[model samples]
Target chain A: MALRVGVVGGGQLARMMIAPAVELGVELRVLAEAEGMAASAAATAVGDYRDAETVVAFARDVDVLTFDHEHVPQEVLAALVDAGIPVRPGPGPLRFAQDKLAMRARLAELGMPQPDWAAVAGADDLGAFLAAHGGRAVVKTPRGGYDGKGVRVVRDPDDAADWFEAAQGAPLLVEELVDFSRELAQQVARRPSGQMRAYPVVETVQRDGVCAEVIAPAPHGGDRLSAVAASIGTAIAEGLDVTGMLAVEMFETTDERLLVNELAMRPHNSGHWSQEGAVTSQFEQHLRAVLDLPLGTAEPVAPWTVMVNILGGPEVGDIDGRFAGVMSEHPSAKIHTYGKASRPGRKVGHVNVSGFDLDDVAYEARAAASHFD
Target chain B: MALRVGVVGGGQLARMMIAPAVELGVELRVLAEAEGMAASAAATAVGDYRDAETVVAFARDVDVLTFDHEHVPQEVLAALVDAGIPVRPGPGPLRFAQDKLAMRARLAELGMPQPDWAAVAGADDLGAFLAAHGGRAVVKTPRGGYDGKGVRVVRDPDDAADWFEAAQGAPLLVEELVDFSRELAQQVARRPSGQMRAYPVVETVQRDGVCAEVIAPAPHGGDRLSAVAASIGTAIAEGLDVTGMLAVEMFETTDERLLVNELAMRPHNSGHWSQEGAVTSQFEQHLRAVLDLPLGTAEPVAPWTVMVNILGGPEVGDIDGRFAGVMSEHPSAKIHTYGKASRPGRKVGHVNVSGFDLDDVAYEARAAASHFD
Candidate 1:
């Protein structure tokens, strides 16, 4: 009786899980989007995840079904659950991550701190909400928005008219633009049996709304911020009955209060620093939690850890060719690549550096990551 | 072009190399002994290492050829080199690891410290050597012996008569049984370009000639021992012209002098602790050295780290069932399984624990490993 774990997506998140899966003696089978995808390193079945028949066939062989992303359709997820296959985070909680308006309303009901937001049906509704809150607002589509797509900053209601037309009557959300000092991410894991653990909050630097780097134990983020972040993570895990990994993306406002901004029901890019910094990586923890196994410690192993993502640049050559120079310059930096080809703005890999000195670790991580570019 | 590395064995060593190979962006292809071997996680070709044509064909696509074990028959290795395939630790040096007689002769010529030894052909030769030295001696077949096999301790020459008959005139070595307090292993990686790095000497515990545990920065091991071990490792790397990972298993006598015992020309069991304990893992270092890439730092990440091997026991069920309790109890202990099936006394996996305190780390590592047993 092999303990088989099936992952729904074969992106980098799923690819990174291969190392821990091999170490744990667990059989992992991934439903990759296509051949040569990031996670093709493991046992893979390339098929459309949107097809219920294909996804259900993949789930039939696994003890538990989980995901690399929260993009699976709700109806398809329901079929798996109805068939008695265990799906972590279930469809009920994953809907929040799928739809922005639903997440805002749920957080409000749960009495969680968030930016003032409202669901707008059209341009007229957006204009009213903008007048009531502030002149400027962030407008977003409820579904399919990620990494700056399906999102826009609006000074006037007309700016969102195109989105309303594209939505075809689906509700959209407009919220007051948050003036945050810095962005932080809190990662937490939960088992269906109620066991839970939270990692140290990390500060993330973004370029063009994409994560560029992450610093563990966020700089100047004292006990107050940590406590607030942990509380938020724990509440989300319990409130949503989420099993497996949960990432709470937060905004530390200029006034010093933390506001929840986004939610990811799987391993997030911001927690990539933990792969070298923490005793147990989030990818490993996710497997344990989803399998109802005891959770691992989320404690930091180093004083400071910095992770910089290697976004594809103009240089077109084999990545291994650059290893000699970069490795010679920064021998302690740990590099991880997704086995992906170079394409501008794509996250091809990341570098992690952990040490006693924060500045040194940060510099090494950034320098090593930039080498690929 | 991608940097392709071809390994000539499909054991756990090659399996473990897959992780680091993926991280380093090197496309690793292994010539496995059979289908479904441990290293099948990577691109693999099932072939016999003894067959020169199969091995050479396998090496055709690789930029550099290496080995997961020294058992790849010297002639086949020579053929690979003759074909202009870059083989790290070229057959000239790999001969030392393949034959004890050659290793001992070379070490003696290099003026290295070792037990008084002789190449014995028969009972008569054994008797003369035993009489000249102490009555008690250790006898071993020069080639194809591992994990206590083909080795015996004897006070009478008659004790080695059976081995002599089995050898049928193949060479054998007999050495005076050195009185040693504990065994220490120093692991070093060398590149063809003359770059080298040494890891801290670790105290190894052996059970029936198999490595059972390793404690890094050896307990109560002073600076004098560390310097001596590092020097021995450096000398061997330069003296043997060995390229890639070299493990020197030595005897730390009660009198505080070191005697060379065994040599491994690739990643060794004693270096397994480096996966969690050191800044650069021996597997990754081996890849770098073999590829002639710049080596990484071999510094220890923690003050103390303990590694305990997981020997398969009689428990006949899924190994994953035990992981829940063991991981819950010792969340920080890192477990590395070879994706092997359970069999009594087999080297199935290992556990590593690193922290500030030696006693605590040792306890956690042993306890977690015991669960599998």
Candidate 2:
């Protein structure tokens, strides 16, 4: 019997999964919004993500419902779960991911360490948050923020005063712009049967607020930090009853404290290192976890693995030369190109390098993954 | 523009090439017997390998001509080349691969060390050959023999009564049985531009005339054996002006001699170790070599890597349990299952495992790939 998986979006993550899913004999059905999308499964039923009827019908033919993105409406997700479809990171848990304020409120109740934050309804609320944290505070809309979009460090309330008035009217979250040393992410997989596994915590570098690179085992390594991050990731999965892959993006502060920055319940870009670095690639592990086919080994293939994101900046034209140079120079580096068109700051692809010298690989890996237009 | 690859056969090698070709953005077009074959480029023109007209038409559309098997008639291949299609391992070179007598003649002319051998067309010639190499000799059809098929060992002349009576005369080759300790394979890739690269010699174990397992960086730590085998493989590829992959199956004699037994021009089963063990997989390297793209690194990903073939012997039912059990136990083992139905001694699939422990992983990998039945 073939296990059917219905993905809600048609992007590269879904596209990359096609190879492994087909190889594993798993039936992958995609309810993509557009035709000619990468990784569009053969069982694809093209439809709009905004349409609940299309989504529900797509779910009907699948054994399990998963996602390629978190853009689906809560109402649509609830409709699927209401009809008895086994959706990973079920609506109850996904709501926390969709609504940042609700997530902060819930996590606050759970006693997790995040930055000091407050929900702001208007300029007055923003002013109050600014007063509590420093004079400057980071303002983020409760929904639809990714890769630095919908996020701003506003020194004055007048900056987004008019736009915030017309948008979703959803309460915004305001936090102090912490002076962080670096950012890190923890990738974990969980099964409905309560089995769980976590990969090593990796330090991520952000450029223009988008992930530019990641260093595994976190620079200035400490076994305790890995344990702490893994424990937190496990607690989140168990506490939320989350199923499948989850990536908890964290901020490692100057004092060595790890703070939750954001959460993703699918294969995230931060976990890309595992594709060539770990015993099992994050893509395969996500498929295994989603199918409940048993999680794979998470041991690192090398002592150190560094991943660098290839941003589609002004350097896009250098893809060809860079690829050749990287292949020739750092022969050990594993480069993964997403076959995407270039756009400023858009993620086009990435490169991973594994060796004993983590820092050296990180330097070479960044150069390898970065486009040179 | 997509790079066009012309494959000569639509068998499993072509089928396996589809995945990597698609990933590497090569347009694969096979000259198969019929449509609906497993390779990405299934033959659209229904014809025979002996028909030069059909093969020429197939080659016209493809940028480069390679092969899935060595069975294509030499005259047909030469005709296509004369018509100006770039047939890799050109007709003159491929003839050496097709006929054992041609290969042996060339090897002996090149002063390469191989088993003492001779070709016989009749009983008189066979008797003289047998007399020269003891009373016992291995009788082979010289052409159309593979997988322990059509080759036999016999002591008495009466044992040759049947083959001799049937011989009404096709060419045949007789050679002294090699008293070797173990068998090994050296895989190498050569480009049309005269660039060549060789992977470490891998120890291969055959059972029931079929390849059962291959271990890379051959166990017992014989660095000299590996170097010699690699040199021999490189020499053959260069000597034959071969473009694409060349697999040299060699017998490591107890007297410390590496005797060339057979050769495969395309990606061979022996190179499966590159999937997980080497920095670049053989499939990927074959695509690169055929496309004239710069080759990738051939360094091993780990110190030890083992590969085991899954022979779907007749009468074995229910492979799901064994597959799932192995997956559950060895979460890190890279398994490749060709979606072929179970049949006696068929090459259904193979499992490649890599780690620090060669013997332990080899044991587990063989167990996982072998039939549970």
Candidate 3:
């Protein structure tokens, strides 16, 4: 029988895994929240991931369980573990991904470098954090925040009064906003048995707080930074007991320090360039890791690879409608689209270009992605 | 709406297409001969492909109709074309692939290089052809032949008397068995609007009349041979008005002459290396050609790519059981399984290894594929 993997979300990450799953001869079943989600083709069950009964029922047939997102409630995950289901990135490590405050605390406990942060339960707590951090800081909800949601740059404690009310007595995470020269992301895959592999660090560009583009191997990163990024990524993967893929979003401060910015326990936007640039894509590596299979090599296939997101898709039609223009203009660009409807500021697709010349690769990726704009 | 493609057969070719279709955001539906075929994931309809009504019904909702293999009856294909369904490599050209006699005649008419051949109705006719070709020749049934089936090498006319009887008055194709140094295959994709792109010719090795290995951009094929191979592939595609992928298998003779051996109107085994080695895979190129979308570049990502077939999987368990060993030993090899039940001599999967050095790539691919044996 083929190895069966159950994924508990129907977003693009799940959709991307379908390709590698099919190629690897692994049966991937997705528990999608709705009928027409991005991973609908592989969705075998439609139910709320929060419902232990639903998620457990879905995981019954699969040999291992993974996730497309970090939103499954701790209780639901614990229920699966209690039921003897192999939930990778089990509730133990998932707690950190599901809650920013937990991740910050865990990183600090592990002696990992991170921006100074504090758990602020009230206005007074937040005011004190801001006062010690040049009167400016970043406030974030401890849970349920992604892609700039539930995060804010505040100059005063009063600026986050509404969030504090929403938290309802729970502490929110507040951190000093470090002055960074650029944002970089490092990814590592870890198997349940402790095997690990790290992809090269990449530089990510964001617009409106959403990932706009990514350059693999992070241009001008040099040997020290690359080694440091990989070390930090591997250290965290081991410290958190993270199985499957872990993407560490980090800040390269003006003072040459690499500080942990965020943590994602699933395939992230920053690793998308690896789909065409690396020996093994994160989607494929994630499946291998979660299954406890040996990890594939994470070497880069090309010297440079650039990825540009096609946010919001085309203005009038689906992303497919723009294939002709983009394919003809940039034959070497690899276009990947999420089966999603066009909506302002929504991520609908991405283009990847890999070659020896970084400039040409970036230009081709950006030009091809522009067609979907 | 996403562009939908309907494939007439549910074999490995169709199964492979699903990965690219999902990644490209195109909807693919397949008509399988049975419930649990290789392409079960995309098989929307289960019926006989030779039945015109069944095929037509399956093609109703798709934007374009294509094939996983060139075995769909001419009548069934005609019905699809008559119904105004966009059938890529339409009946007009598919007839050449369906009948070897027809293909030989057409290629001769087009002034192409091929083995000297004749259509023989009885032993007497066969005897005459064999007497003139060094008393040894190859005889083949014009229809229903694949993987060395329905083909025979005869030293005397009486050797093929059984085949002559099976013909029942229809003529069998007889050809001079030319001595060749090696075999090679060239693939070309053509759109309905005449756009064309050719992939590099690759060398193929046959074991027990089945393809066992392939080396992309065939070693020792200099600029002149490469150009000639591509020209022949494109010429045949254009001459036959074939839209989608066309594979032209040829013999590189001892005297350096390239002669046409066979034709396949769908993605063939020789081009499988492209899935991981080339910028645009044959499966993806086939989809683009059939949809009339601009073709992607058919450029190799590495200096060399070697592919080895995993015939007749493990004697005890499924291919998945061997992943740990193979993956651990050869992390750079890309393995692709067909999700088929293992049977003696069946093509269960393949491994692709690409890198700057051909020797290492070939060794890694072979080592990885050996795991399945």
* Residue pairs in collision within model 2: A15-A39, A315-A373, B314-B344
B225-321 in candidate 3: lDDT tens per residue?
9999999999999999999999999999999999999999999999999999999999999999999999999999999999999999876864565
Per-prediction interface RMSD? 1.3, 3.1, 0.5
**For candidate 1, lDDT tens digit of each residue in A1-373?**
4578999999899988877877776778999999988887774699989989899988997999999899999989989988899998799989999988989998888888999998888989988888886688999888999998888999898998888988899889888899999999999999999999999999999999999999998999888889889999999888988899999999999999999999999999998888878988999899989999999889998999999998984356645667777888989999887878788899988999999999899889989887877
Give the DockQ (2 decimals) of all models.
0.69, 0.39, 0.89
Compared with the true structure, the alpha-carbon lDDT of candidate 2 equals 0.78
- Error of model 2, residue A122, in angstroms: 0.7
lDDT of 1 by residue, B287-324 (tens): 99999999999999899999999987435865566877
TM-score to native of every candidate shown = 0.98, 0.92, 0.99
**How high is the lDDT of residue A122 in model 3?**
88
lDDT of 2 at A182: 86
Residue-level lDDT of model 3, residues A90-198, one tens digit each, is 8989999989999999999999999999999989999999999999999999898889998899998899999999889999999999999999999999999999999
- The top-ranked prediction according to TM-score is 3
